[model samples]
Target: MQTSSFIGAVDIMSTQTATERPILHGGRREAMREAYPAAPQPWIDLSTGINPIPYPIPTLPAECFTRLPDPEAATRLESIAAAAYHVSDAAMVAAAPGTQILIELLARLLPQQRIAILGPTYAEHQAAWARGGGSVDLIPDLDDLPAASSLVLCNPNNPDGRIIPPARLRALADHLAARGGLLVIDEAFADLADRATSMAATLPHPAIVILRSFGKTYGLAGVRLGFALADAPRAAAIRTALGPWAVSGPAIAIGTIALADPAWLAATQHRLTHAAATLDRLLTDAGMTIIGGTPLYRLAATATAPDWHDRLARAGIMTRRFDDHPSWLRFGLPADHTAWARLAAALSGNRPPLANHPDQ
Candidate 1:
């Protein structure tokens, strides 16, 4: 199931595995082409945690795209997002293009010598910290968290949905705060988690910063909306750093409407829960070991994961495959019945039905 790739740069056998797997982020259709040129068309991409069913975008005003985003309109969007997230104060939330922006800036916000990150979580946190000249330590166990100037971790983490309780996190925050340390929690997958798990509603602390990704839950990544929840001072500093019009008018308008729709939120959550259950069964039946992940995606462990990745790629069913953890494959929700059928056929090693085939 495992294969080797040689770069010949060094004779050393590095477990880094960058050559054996995709080194970049998922949903790379062009990379799929380089690997499997003869694969069939209509690729069913289940490579990201993005919701398969996106929020319905409303008709935008001409001014939204043509002119600069109004400060008042941005404020309105922040207010609505604050309400949706149960954040009491709109000032505590700083809107940006996406959570990725916040993640990159966090290292600079808190000048620290050592940054302890809980992993194998999101790769960006480590990369960002390293970029900002912080020595990064990867802590495998929660109990073994090292005393550091700053800490970064994910709540309901990516690749695998791992959550730490609010009370426990608060205690960690208190511990970090005593030593002038900062704790950055990425709650990107927290939407699918229970309401009690979110710390967004709670009073902000100077030592604690929470990041929420609107694109993942709302299925509007192109809208490029995300927020950083922190104390008044930190929020203000972030906003100042971002400057005016960091988010576009169209993003503000679309994000506001989507966040305000409680009915759509409830229905989508319900539908996603059911869909996740269906996906779990399919993966298990396909001879995979369920590892972790939320309703938006499922992480499965298999001995033949690399082979399966190649097999599915050849069938044009693109999934998120990890190089570091070679056994893991993350499957996002299929958009529709046809997508589901295609995935099932690919998993079963059967050619998809020929009707309307892209190559045919």
Candidate 2:
């Protein structure tokens, strides 16, 4: 799927040079507002890997907010997550407001030394380590990781979906564990990709910690729920660092229900797979080279990625472009047929059909 049959055919303003724009993250509609004041209403945001069709949220009991989060409910949520992730022990799971918080906590908990992060990843790992006063390095491959006291990487990586074999990662974890070092694996997108690549199924190691994001897969980022899978001591340390009531009552209730619902998971997986394939077809039809991505999103390599991005933005269709990788652009799956047609028309530089009106 790297090269497309429609290459050099679609007129996406490919000849026009686009002005360099500041890097912006997905779901930041306000940023888009400032960038494109009169583009359109209800922007079609395809910059993030989050599922466009969010899970159906259950109505919460009033007590979810009136009272403090129950420790037992939090425990139950962790247990559900543990079972969902195939964690060997429920005690190994620690619930947090978000995995971003857990990443900071891990950076603070782990010993300060050379921390190597697999390159071109979610930028927070390096910043979080720096915030915790830990030294950092961005290594391109796993072979260059031995010298670092702690190594962090996103499995089924962000922007471009790259996955490291579980066995190879486990060997690295064992090596780091033997030296009292840490190996952090961010499995944010693993829910939609190959689940076997997750370290959750592996036996707990003193030096290994896996961060699982509940929001991305479940499409409830507003819930701010995430989990850390680690040995008891490390899990306890993260809990202690986050303090009491680290996760809200509503979050626990929602996470427990969502993670435990195997039926919903299966259905959503199928829906996302179908949606991703549709997105691939749409992008390829627009002459973009689909390099790689998980079911949640597609990454394209193109000589005129910037121009395509600009054209799309003008049409109120937002996609992610990397500052470092000028030729690369990432597109998340559109929510419905209307959004699909809207993006297709934007990329092809044609007006969206009136019948397939863009939804707000």
How high is each candidate's TM-score?
Answer: 0.91, 0.89
Clashes of each: 0, 0
Number of the top TM-score candidate: 1
On residues 94-125, what C-alpha lDDT tens digit does candidate 1 reach at each position? 99999989988887776679998888877777
TM-score of 1: 0.91
- Alpha carbon deviation, residue 337, candidate 1 (Å): 0.9
lDDT winner: 1
lDDT of each: 0.81, 0.80
Candidate 2 displacement at residue 167 in angstroms: 0.6
Error of 2 at 209 (Å): 0.3
Mark the regions of model 2 whose C-alpha exceeds 4 Å error after superposition. 1-24, 349-360
